[model samples]
Target: MTLRTIVVDDSIIFRKVMRDALSAIPGVEVVDIARDGSSAVDKIVAAKPDLVTLDIEMPGLNGLEVLEELDLRGIQTNVIVVSAHTSRGAEVTTQALSMGALDFILKPDNDNAGANLAQLKSELARLLKMVKAQPQLSMVSSSPAKSETLSAPIVARAPVRTTKTTSVPRPVECNLENLKTPKFPHLCHAIFIGISTGGPKALASVIPKLPATFTIPIVIVQHMPPLFTATMAKSLDNTSALNVVEATHGMPLAGGGVYIAPGGKQLGVKADARGNVIAVVTDDPPIKSCKPSVDYMMSSVPSSIARNSLAVIMTGMGDDGRDGVSYLRQNGCTVWAQSAESCTVYGMPRQIIENGLADFAFDLDDLPNLLSQLAYRAGGYCPVPPIPSTTAPMMATN
Candidate 1:
């Protein structure tokens, strides 16, 4: 199965380089190349290739505008943004994700062209595999008009609950009775989310829909680079009723706030003397090739916290959160996965479901309400006992 592909870039050299790289990947055919955005859009709408490598900084009709135009015209195709490492590039790449690109690869800045192309080729291959595995590639426009932040009521969809019997758990009937009468008298102390590919758009759909009065402290590890995570956090904060900020060391993990783990650092939580959980940012090495890894963050969750936390594994390209989720579930944490139909890449969530670690799985539209309900109705607001200072001393973890 040859994946028809297009390379869209202003640089003649990069276009050729990308073409050669794509050719090296098995089953990828370079159907066409466009020198700029207008030509790229025209060629795309005409050829309708299976994949496109887009350069975000085209001279006219930049990559973002091209995505907007495609959304307006209802064109369906997988797009991988080839982006520079500049601040502007990071900002626009974040926007591109929210606008519905499947994923992105950073343009290597090193002068060694061979090394750069090798990295690009590896990243592109991974993203292509993710795109090919998706059951559906068509997507609705993520523009403001179609955004889920409006007052439209979300109709409940039945959640997918599974129990381990074999290697991969088979879905059983959703038992609302079981959900309501869990062993724990309440839902959770905190909500921890792990997402990667297609995360920005998904998070945009969820975080803003959460009511301002909802007070559960939500911590997120969205696999991204440094500047990219900060930019994404700012974007979410602008639209969200809940205060959203990039997690910093010593920051209090309090209610009514959403903390995004900083991109290049490991984020963990430790209880302060005042009983409030505070952020712990460390220069730890990457876990499973991901800095600020979901595993690292969730592993840092204390047993007291884990026993009462809800771990959400959403759309992503890899199984970074699986081990962490395993630990959490073992400690009595409840786990939820975003359903395949709602995920851009079902890799992460599928692992949870397959490993029998998921307590529930839901569509993107149904999650915000479910989270709010469990957080508010299930006695999630029990306040932490007050202590002295908001900050806590960082502790070393083995």
Candidate 2:
């Protein structure tokens, strides 16, 4: 099946380049192109393609305005916002995601376009394949994730026949109450997480559910560019009970706060002279083609804060968190993975689950309660239920 797509950008050069780049993909086809927001919307309504590459700074009406129009008119379209790497661009991209754009790509500035566009092409193709294979990620209404505890059974789609990456397959749904959680040497001192793709919406969904009395320090590695992470942290801070801030070098880890690893930099942990663990922000080379890599953050914890860690791997594009999770497991740290149905991409956690590295697996909406039970001790009623080895995995009816 051809991955039908449209490019909506005002720049003639970018329009041509993006069209050519997408056309070069084996299963993708550029269905149409629009130079302005109004025309983009009109053509989108007409073509109704599988995906749209929208520019945030288009003339007549901005990209966000076009999304507003689409929402008002009830036109169902999957949007991928192509935005600049500036602070303003990050702010708008956040708004776009909240407004229902599935994700955004960082368009390089004029000086680095030649080198960076190649990377952009690869990312665009990867996302297109992801969106095509998973219809759940391309929701036309509401945010990607909802801020609710696990109440409804997951509605699965026709099983996507993927090339089996491992011999031992994970059951579709394991009963968490019956599954044995990993034992730790001490109470979970901090929460370390890695997420991508649908994370902005996921964070918004999960953070509000965390109570103010919860005191576990949370550190997140969300794959993004320099200023984007800061903007995302600020957005989450406004609605959350805990204080959320962008991570800075030398900042000591503290309870009752959330720290986002600054984008375009690798964030690691280290012990200070007084033996207190602190954030180490650096411009180290990208791991698995990603700065702020999950592996980078997870690896840092094993030495400084391993035994008291509660590591989580969530939605993302690749196995970036695998090695780090392995490290956490080897060091006696507890780890949890988000269930596949609740994930936008299901790559990171899928790798850990398939490898039998995760201690517990929970749905995305159930994140807050899981955190409460483990970190806050607020859900003590369900704390560490007896594991039932004879139980069968529950299947999700499509």
Candidate 3:
């Protein structure tokens, strides 16, 4: 199926260049072009393209203004920001993301415009695929038969309960004393996690259950836009017993603390002169179209923790964590994937599982118990056996 797109920019030359770049991508067709944000809104309301490429610095109701208008009008078209490569541009682009833009591309300068344009073409194609495969829209809007055909596998794999329970206990508050040290020898210095799709809800369920006595620092790469990650961190902080914040460069990784990579930056763990682990945030080129790519984080952890790391790949839309999981496993760091039945989208975990990269395949509900067991073992407090296969049989529904 063809993905209809619209280009909105004030610069005539840039618009033409973007048009050509998008046209080169298969299954994508540009349906309209607008000179500025106001006209872009008009064209969007009329043409209703599946995607939009919006320039940030346009005159007469800038890119962000257009997004605000679209939101007010309840338009849900995927919008990608095309902005100049400057600190101010980055800040504005980040703000646009908070306002609900899906992604951003640094505008190419005249010197390397061709190469950058080609990169944009690749990025646009990737965006198209993600938009088309978005399960929420497809499942809610399509006819029952069509939705069944599209979502049968996912529905069939969902978990079942013997009895529905409406009441859930409030999560305990995180504190150092609450962290329980384990009896087993220390095997890992850091914990790495990658999640996507239904990650927000899943994280809310799991993170709060983590003990504040957990000694190793935790880092996460959840597939999300800037503003969304910020909100997610805040939500986690409120629910979790431990402190949860968006990661910043040079910050120490405190025990029982969780650091979420900020949007628009790739997060890496680096050692300081003191040999302490610190967070590094950079505007380096994205890995797999995600600033805080799971593979990027997983690949770096083994080095940062020096063979004493644990990598976990969870629900997501693609195989971004597959290679990193392999790297961690080969290097003697433990690696795990969320089992298919418990996932909202099983793409990342499925890749790791199919490749035999996972040391443990766990259900989401069982994760808190697993972590508690791991902690007990690490602190020489208890003897927990190796994690067993937690994959449940797929449930079928009419």
| Most accurate candidate by TM-score | 1
Ten contiguous residues minimizing lDDT sum, candidate 3: 152-161
Order by TM-score, highest first: 1, 2, 3
Cand. 2 Cα-lDDT: 0.74
lDDT for 231 in candidate 2 is 96
- Put down candidate 1 lDDT per residue, 302-391, tens digits, no spaces: 666777778999998677777778877877898888877788877788777766777787889988888888776766555454445644
Q: Model 2, stretches more than 4 Å misplaced?
A: 71-76, 110-120, 132-186, 273-275, 378-398
Q: Model 1: clashing residue pairs?
A: 274-387
How well is each residue in 245-283 modelled by candidate 3, as lDDT tens digits?
Answer: 999887987667889988777776655544466776766
Q: What is the lDDT of residue 141 in candidate 1?
A: 20
In model 2, residue pairs whose N, Cα or C atoms come closer than 3 Å (at least 3 residues apart or on different chains), thus clashing, are none
Q: What are the per-residue Cα lDDT tens digits for candidate 2 across 1-398?
A: 56678899999999988887788788777889999999998988888777899999977999999999989988877889998888899999987876778789887665676666677688787787677555465533223432212122222221111211112233346445543453333565678899988788788888878989777788999988889999999998998988999999989777788999998888886545454557888777677777887877777663336666788998876777776777777767788888878887777777777667788877888788778777644221111222244433211112
Query: 1 or 2: which has the higher lDDT?
Result: 1
**Which stretches of candidate 1 lie above 4 Å from their native place?**
138-187, 385-398
